[model samples]
Target: MSAPEQRFTPVLLTLPGLTPTLALEILPHGVTLHRLFVQADGRTHDLLIGPENPADHLTQKYTNTIVGRYANRLPVNQDAFPLSRNGHSSTFTPQSNESPTVSLHGGRVGFDYVEWTPLLDPSESQLFTDAEKSHLNGSDGVVGVIFKRISEDGEEGYPGRLLVETLVSLVEPSGPQAESVKTGSELKLGSVVIVYRAKLLDEGKVTPINLTQHWGFNLDASLKESLTVKEHTLSIKADHTIELNNVGLSTGSLLPVTGTHHAHAEKESKKIGEKWPTSGYDEFYVFSPRSTPTLPTRVPVSEFTPTSDLLKEIITSEASSKDPLVQLASEKSGLRVSFDSNQSGVQFYSNNLTNEKNGARKKIHGGSGVSGAGDSYGVGSAAFLEFHEPLAAWLNPSTIGHSGNDTLLASGEIYNNFVKMDVWFKSPVA
Candidate 1:
């Protein structure tokens, strides 16, 4: 196990009868998500960004990796577009030379730098039925891990031949709702669930898959000082976004985040160091619905309730009906993170160029990167919430003029997406 100890091999996921224990880490370069320890009220907190070794996630080029076959940007030569299948035609270049203008995430060796293949299952009964122990709040059983990969076809340039799958479970919370998620009082919980499947082995052509998992959170794992994520405290179920352009791409318009431009505006829950020196946040908000004329009811996916009392607006709920499109908290380490997605846009990056003079992050279309120290990283330090599909359904499916918006993946179709995470704290006497 050399080669940097086989590239920091360590895939843990403990949560079997969780209560004061909640571990997470699935790293093998690109399957990334380094660590997430938690221990609730008695206070433990390591919520995320727990990697300082193993090359420290190579200074964030795709930090918690898993990027895409088309995660973020796309548009090449003469604003490329058009990928006909059974009739041939293809044109949406920049497959990966490292980028100087177009295809960002999924061009240069896309799938987050590659390296996957792990299908774990460590069990011994640890049963749970009683309606799965009343929606896990009791704490008894569940530990999963499935990270397979295979992008062949046209590799990063984008085409058919794809087969990606990722599942990182770790549940156990159901003793009659474990005192409402172990005393947050009632609802604001998640043991962990991140599924994302993809399959399209060219049964006749037609491709365009967008996946995301650039998870980067830093809940003050303190090391004396320097733990500023601008003091953390944000909530976004999206009131509208995706309007970039000026070197950030996405000019398909669709504004209104409460009057745009303040880093793409935000309706409430503010305070990420007071919205930064201004030019941070990358863009793309919009929760669901890609058509039916800008969303005329088709946002259904809520009812997963499991309350018990103790609701102060459940801490400003908003993930679009399902009530958790994205919410981050850190009232001085009382940690709180919630994100739910069926995927229809949710970029939000504020790592703003990862420092070390910014160089060494190449791969816009080329390959090989990882330079260093640009103050090691500034403003907020770490922040991202990618969730894919619908940046105007791939650049411009009429840019939201919507005609039953179709982001292509044709032939038999199947390119699933899932993102649900929950971490607690905020009543341990803060």
Candidate 2:
């Protein structure tokens, strides 16, 4: 119960060359990802959904926020989970800033709500080289920013002093991808790459850590119309899901998607409306360890099962390590967002709680378009797709059911991960 930290101004990262360029806002508060703008079809549209200001939320919910210390959840009951290393054992209590029932998003004062400092002169802390920059884009000009923070030992009742660095870069198309722009044969696509690196500052002390960008996206340019995400089409490459309990906690069961909306969607894309009967998608899709990592096959964005009135763009694959774990397309704008990550799993949460205010049902307008100091925010206004380590990996390290890897961030080891977002838009014939 200490006073809350002061919020800082937002910083913008933009790619200026592309017609419909990409822009992102990096907020000092909670090191949050605030605003995202993509130039598509002769228009620049903001794609993120949440309150305009960071202080208006009754609950942080980590909207477009950087979540960690431990990203997801760690089970802590009457008999807390036991942790042992080098003959030392400790119990993780459910104590958190979130709720007494569980430890959510690094407890009450988790990094999401706290002020994060950027390293002095990001240019001095440049982690990428000319070759690395060239790999991102052939363009002479590229833009990037690096933010860093130090988590004191036991800051959130977590062990070890942890140092985290995040780099947000807007790299334009390169090689063949860049050539298509001149030919006007292919839809231009640029990337917003997030690089995360963390290390344990205290020797011989370990911590369970997971980090993610809680991104909720909507592709529409005109917000005057009442928009619901039900019309969006989605495709996920995985075949299995990590099950969840009623309150959004993992049940430690890796189950086949089967007849559910969370099924393996590589062959075909499905509409969001089809899953209306359920609580939307709040499950983790597991990429099989047996599968080879390779570049995704390109296809028309329109191939994601577009409806006539809604289809505004075509989908094409980027040269990524694998096909996107999740592909979301809007028929209205032809704006398609493909999400890829090195993390073990992806969490999709339909902004189902936007309409709920102070625990009651109410209509509140919130998103990048409107101020969110109101009691209620936009309900189902967008969809949150999170890239991170598997849920409950800390509780059941051996049984968390990630493809093949475990979740423990050992002492003296660096945890490096990244998430990529590719936005493609198609214009109507003049």
Off by over 4 Å in 2: 1-6, 16-20, 54-60, 78-80, 84-91, 123-141, 177-186, 221-223, 293-322, 356-376, 397-403
lDDT against true structure, model 2: 0.61
- Go through the candidates in order and give each one's C-alpha lDDT: 0.57, 0.61
The lDDT, on a scale of 0 to 1, for candidate 1 is 0.57
After superposing candidate 1 on the true structure, give the runs of residues whose Cα lies further than 4 Å from its correct spot.
Answer: 1-39, 42-166, 171-195, 207-234, 237-252, 258-335, 338-344, 347-386, 391-422, 428-430
The weakest ten consecutive residues by lDDT in model 2 span 308-317
TM-score for each of the candidates: 0.30, 0.80
lDDT by residue (tens digit), candidate 2, 228-248: 677788777666777777666
In candidate 1, where is summed lDDT lowest over 10 consecutive residues? Answer: 292-301
lDDT of 1 by residue, 1-430 (tens): 6756655687877775425368877876778877667776565555544334545565455877778776777655645456764454455455535456667777777777767766443121111112322322323355656677778776755666776667666655433544543444533334566656565656666667767888777676432244457777777656677676766567777776664433332355667777475667777777534322221112111221233211111112233224565777776666677765556657777777655455332222121234453334354566777876655364465444222324556444444456666666556432
> Evaluated with lDDT, which candidate comes out highest?
2
lDDT of candidate 2 at residue 426, scale 0 to 100: 57
